[model samples]
Target: MSDKYAVPNKLPAKQVNVMTHRKRRLREEESHHRVKRLNRSFKLRSKKRDYKKPEFFITQYLKAERDSKRMRRVIMKNNFLKGVDDEEPKLLVVMHHRAHRVASKECTLIMNSMGLNRLHNTVLLKNTTESLALLKMIEPYVVYGYPTIQTVRDLIFKHGFLRIKGKRTAINSNKLIEEHLGEHGCICIEDIVHDLFTVSDNFKNVRSLLLPFSLKAPRDGWSKKIGVSYSRGGEYGNRKHEINALIERCL
Candidate 1:
């Protein structure tokens, strides 16, 4: 017989057999395919992903949050502030951004000296329909933040977004608001500040101030008489300690 087609002549003497060898080879190949299919299924169920996030937007948000916390720390000093607790601010110095922090600090200082801290009034006004509800709830002083370029934009956006349709709440207007104060009563702003802060030399006779440190100039018509102006925040930069002196003079 030809060698290619010939059966093994020595098979009878062999320890290993062709049938056993063929079965082992088929088992290995079947196991390999089974393992491959299992791997494919596992990959399909895996939670790992190659997705990435938008870098710039995330960085901007993080930066803004960090800045906000830092500003809050300076504005809401533990020695003076206790957060917006069960009580609201009495002299609500409304502000929008970085200047917001300075205005808040000034007002806080003003309120502390004027003794309005005892009255448990005042709070920052947010532009929201819920803000109106909260206003009714808190009866805040509506001190305006300076309508600076950005603040003006923010105001327009906020007002457009949060304004209510019904009659907007009117700020307080009357003689009760205009108290006699400041250097023999010659300066009207001091008395108003005092009323807003609720301070007295006698340590008594006072109520909460409404939005006293606000960016708003003095109330309408009386602003010129009182010499009120929109104070640039820059004026307070190095002379911050002088704010205490200015407030004291008013007191």
Candidate 2:
């Protein structure tokens, strides 16, 4: 048994680089084992410390505290910087169709690239020149506009999710947010909300981390069909702030 467990003799040191590669592989194997041990210890300690509580309670508490601090900061900032630094505009684009006769394949590809592949799929976009150009290309198949703070919050709380390891996971606890986005200064749900509502510098990263919101069809359905301008009482094009009313019904 002892002989079976012994480390194998090193290969004949042919090519100094091969020896270096072998050493690197061994180091990686050791590090992997170390990490496994640490995780095991952590789980054991957790079980010993609080058998009754769920494993994620600490993550939830930390997340709640972080969110509270962020909210307080927002309140204080709003009070002091009411008009000093107005937030940049953001666009809430909703897809009502996949392909349209008026839309080219390139336009549909742009929409799909933006994660709006299904009917009633919604995404928040920064109002930059590039985004505006893309929206122009797909304007005939979607509705978009400036969303109010309440609308942003409601959407996150009700339909918001984080994409982790390419899986759509619910925002049920702060631990999830921290695990996925803590490095980006978003440790809680409120951090993402603030970043999006204010269109902060981290908005792009936060938006990409979030899964597209799958909204229900607008409560009475579209009054006007797609492939026309919203000004003409059509469903496509900008609804401005009026988009809020449409999103509310879907919510």
In order, candidate lDDTs are 0.34, 0.74
In angstroms, the error of model 2 at 180 is: 1.6
lDDT by residue for model 2 (22-85), tens: 9999999999999999999999877755345675566556654654564455456543332322
Error (Å) of candidate 1 at residue 224 is 29
What is the overall TM-score of model 1 with all chains considered together?
Answer: 0.22
TM-score of each: 0.22, 0.61
Candidate 2 stretches greater than 4 Å from native: 1-88, 97-103
lDDT tens per residue, model 1, 58-133: 7656655654564456545432232333343222223221222222333445434432343312223322334333
Relative to the unseen true structure, what is the C-alpha lDDT of residue 109 in candidate 2, on a scale of 0 to 100? 72
Q: lDDT score, residue 78, model 2?
A: 44
